[model samples]
Target: MASGKHRDNIKQQSKAAAKKSGNSIASRISNSFRNHQQVAVDSLDRLLASISGTLMIWIMIAIAMALPLFLLLFLQNLQQFGSDLDEASQISVFMNTTTEMPRLEQLRDELLGRSEIQNVEIISAETALQEFQASSGFGDILSGLDENPLPPVLLVTPLAQDAAVLQPLLASLQDYPEVDEVQFDLDWLQRLYGILNLAQRLTYMIGLLLALGVALVVGNTIKLAIENRRDEIVVVKLVGGTDAYVSRPFLYTGLWYGAGGGLIACVLILLAQLILQGPVSRLAGLYEGEFALVGLGISGFFMVLLLSAMLGWFGAWLSVLRHLRAIEPG
Candidate 1:
């Protein structure tokens, strides 16, 4: 009778333990869902409050990005213009006046074998005078002057378009015994290249300074938010809230700030670009150029957005950690 009673007691104990386990699991799941909802609500509320500041953040980012973008585009156009001018970057290689036309023709033929040189226009004295008269619109003045003073020249164009490479090539061509002076308008292109490099370096330096400024701005803002909610933080501590629970909302707030600011920056940049587009097009048309500036593509847009959000999050996290520890007991 006692053995049977013992078996029944064991069964009852097992049933009670199973029921307790099931209840605990249900309670945990309910609490987990509730916490998720609470965190979501908290994050959303903070994000709304932060919109105005976030807008300012994005505007700053936009300005920083836009300056570099415009400068880069202008530099690209400058390089393109140099390339276009390359067709005309021809060197006027004047032959030694003593060299006969036949010998000059022989020399031209010999030069034709060189792969580095583009097309060569052999301008005889009469042809040079004629071209100068036509281009200068000085036909009437030239008709009055009985003497034709222009010399025979070979307009030598290099196949390569870069100013750096062209100068060395010109030096090599000038070494020829039959060649006198080699004249080329290489100054403008060289200066343009130099200016472009300087501008790029300046933009990079400014960008670094501005990025640091952004991080500071975010940090200060988070610090202020933390200060404002001192009592609320105290209440959370009294209510047995874990540090992670208190910190999650602020972390979310930072994420939102970065993402929102990044968005605003992108919008501002596009708006600025749109505003400038008409004037740019008109200017390009005046120069008879088909060049069009490119804006940031989809990948670039996403990258900027991601970076902004990340920065904001990091700044907020840094502030929260520094302050949260100070709030707790030693």
Candidate 2:
């Protein structure tokens, strides 16, 4: 009976101990969150006190981020424009002037049946002459001619725009008895591809370099902040403050700097887009095309903000890791 009573007491104690442990953990977590909130607020207040210097840092970061962002946007737009010109990649086949309509149709059908060709459009000599007359302001002169000089043309759009595919197709088309000329100016297309590739590489290189610059800029700023607060950090450590506690405010400072820079960069990009939109639209209109400048939408804006914040945090962490240890209570 005494053993049973002792066992019951032991179980109650065990339950009490477990409850106390859980409460302790919850308390620690809550205190940690509160401490972080206070540190962040203090850091922001300090930055607001030194508004001019903070603004300078933000401007530097903004410029660094904006250049690559603009280049990326330009490259995306250029790629879109290139895709829109898929029809321009077609091969033009001018048939013999004496070729009959039936033979022209037959050749078009044959080309369409091939796996390499996506589509074939045939223009009869009469239709071609009529289009030329309408555009060339030579209707009166053409009417005085003895007979139609234009030949029926076939526009063959290949499934692939690669030079290897196009070259063989051009040769085969030239071999046809009814085809008088086969024209595909591959050089310009190749040049465009090369230019796009070079631009993409340049954008990547510039972005990497600028990203490093941003991190360095934030690191330098954090270093200065640490130096200014050296006495305070030493006092905190002397009072048994942990390294993490001492570094928290500075880390928050770096985050604020990075976030502000990202916001400014976004605003700058938007302003530039607004200024350029009219001119770009006018240019597209001149080419008889409809195009609108695409800016960073909601998702992109949030992504930029998140990236900048992470960079700021990284820079702060790096600075704190390097310098916070060197500052001793003594």
Model 2: residues >4 Å from true position, as ranges?
Answer: 1-27, 79-87, 94-117, 122-154, 158-181, 238-242
Model 2 RMSD, rounded to 1 decimal: 6.8
Candidate number of the best TM-score: 2
- What are the C-alpha RMSDs, in order, of all predicted structures? 9.4, 6.8
Which candidate leads in lDDT?
Answer: 2
Give candidate 2's total backbone clashes: 0
Candidate 1 lDDT by residue in tens digits, 1-330: 999999999888867876877756677679778886787677767657776765676566556545655565556656776677656677889877666788878878877788888777788878888889889998889979877767689888778766667768789889998888888877777787788778778877876676566666777777877888888888888777788878777776776666776777677667766887788789988989765656656887898788777877887888899886567532
TM-score of each: 0.63, 0.72
Whole-model lDDT, model 2: 0.89
lDDT of 1: 0.75
Report clash pairs, candidate 2. none
Could you give candidate 2's per-residue lDDT for residues 16-130 as a string of tens digits? Answer: 8768777566777887999999999989999999999999999998998889999988888887777677557888899999999999889989999999999999999999999
Angstrom error at residue 140, model 2: 10
